[model samples]
Target: MNKKTIAAAFVAVVAAAGIAYWSLGSANAPLRGSSVAAASGNKVITIWRDPGCGCCDAYADYLEGNGYVVTRVDDPNFDKRSIEAGVPQQGIGCHLAEIDGYVVSGLVPAEIIERLVSERPDITGITLPGMPANAPGMAPTKTGTLKTYAFGKDGVTVYSEE
Candidate 1:
């Protein structure tokens, strides 16, 4: 088979597997609403993203669904804002959020976001790097674990896994 055919087949297989997993009806399903409890239902998140990015909309929806008050703005200087917010150059993602004085870079899970709020980490914020397949906004394939990194004066470090 050609390369395109093989890649298409692989995607089809993964999609089938994801469907089967979802059929199990587990509340802890990957990429669904995060299981972590909210630190405060009144918390607000302001997301700066490109208006053309559909995944950003999905990410905003995920945050709102988890009790966060989401305000999405299509900022022309999103990259500049992220850099100014202390997001490391390597940790930059498609979108950025300002939450309770922390800069969240990327489609970070609500669980981790809540943990950051509850624990009050000293870091500037957390990032998920490039968008992962099963991340909150991305297409779900039930892939391997997603790594989140914390960035600040101490530099980038593993924050959590989901």
Candidate 2:
């Protein structure tokens, strides 16, 4: 092939590959993992955290272990993202996660997170402030004490005790 023809073909191939990769793995794509229940349908959670935060990685692992399709975003502007997701001032945690129309602030357990999906509460979302001892992804403590709160424009209220 002539140089011009080869270059054009190469560009075409590259564009095709880029499009395919995006469609298959983009945040909006449907869940592909067997662990996720069909009811959830590729229920992926996108988490925004500080790049150097190790606990955030641990939290992501915990979610994956429970079958959640997780997407990790090490954003320098993570705090802005969390606030934009509507995290209450009192509910801010080490990391922020966005679920189906819900903002999860902090180290909430997979169970609580799943419950939010299952129950489909009317509130905006839930929060686990202060990386509670024994909270999923944090060092397990004997007390296992953590407080989960539900919050929205009306403000924050107790969601549950764990």
Candidate 3:
């Protein structure tokens, strides 16, 4: 099989798995409302991403496909913003996001983001450093890989094996 074919297969598989997980897990969970802004509802999420990045847009679409109402903010200086907001430089990535006071960076999986927001872990944010092509937005048309990192008071930790 060609590389694009493989990538499509992988995406399909991941999407299928994600849908199954969301269905079984959040099916009955109460949707957080506007009263608590930026909190996960069954419908929405707010993300701050670089203005010119196609990958960020693609990632937003991915979230939307998963039943998330993504509010995208175009920030040209996301790196500066992230640093100012206390995200560690070592944990920097292509994008930065905020959900109910929690931070998410780069090609973070929607499921993991959900876990972070729901659990409200004492952490700065999550990051997928260097935007590996296999990451949600960073995926190459053919083949690639990504590493997800979690930023906490203890420092950056590898959250997922990708």
Which candidate number has the best TM-score? 2
Best by lDDT: 1
lDDT of 2 by residue, 1-162 (tens): 999999999999999996676434433333222223325576678777888988899888878877877788667666666676777776788887777767788888777877887888888788888767677777742255578999987888899796
Clashes in each model (backbone N, CA, C under 3 Å)? 0, 1, 1
TM-score of 2: 0.72
Candidate 1 lDDT over 1-162, as tens digits, reads 999999999999999997666433231221221112123456677778887999999888878888887767777677777787789888998898867667889988888888998787899889988878788889633256889999999988899976
Off by over 4 Å in 1: 1-41, 140-143
- Candidate 2 lDDT trough over 10 residues, lowest sum: 29-38
How would you order the candidates by TM-score, starting with the best?
2, 1, 3
- What ranges in model 2 sit over 4 Å off? 1-40, 140-143
User: What's the residue-level lDDT of 131 in candidate 2?
Assistant: 67
lDDT, ranked from best to worst: 1, 2, 3
Listed per candidate, the RMSD to the true structure in angstroms reads 19.0, 7.3, 17.0
Cα error, candidate 2, residue 28 (Å): 15
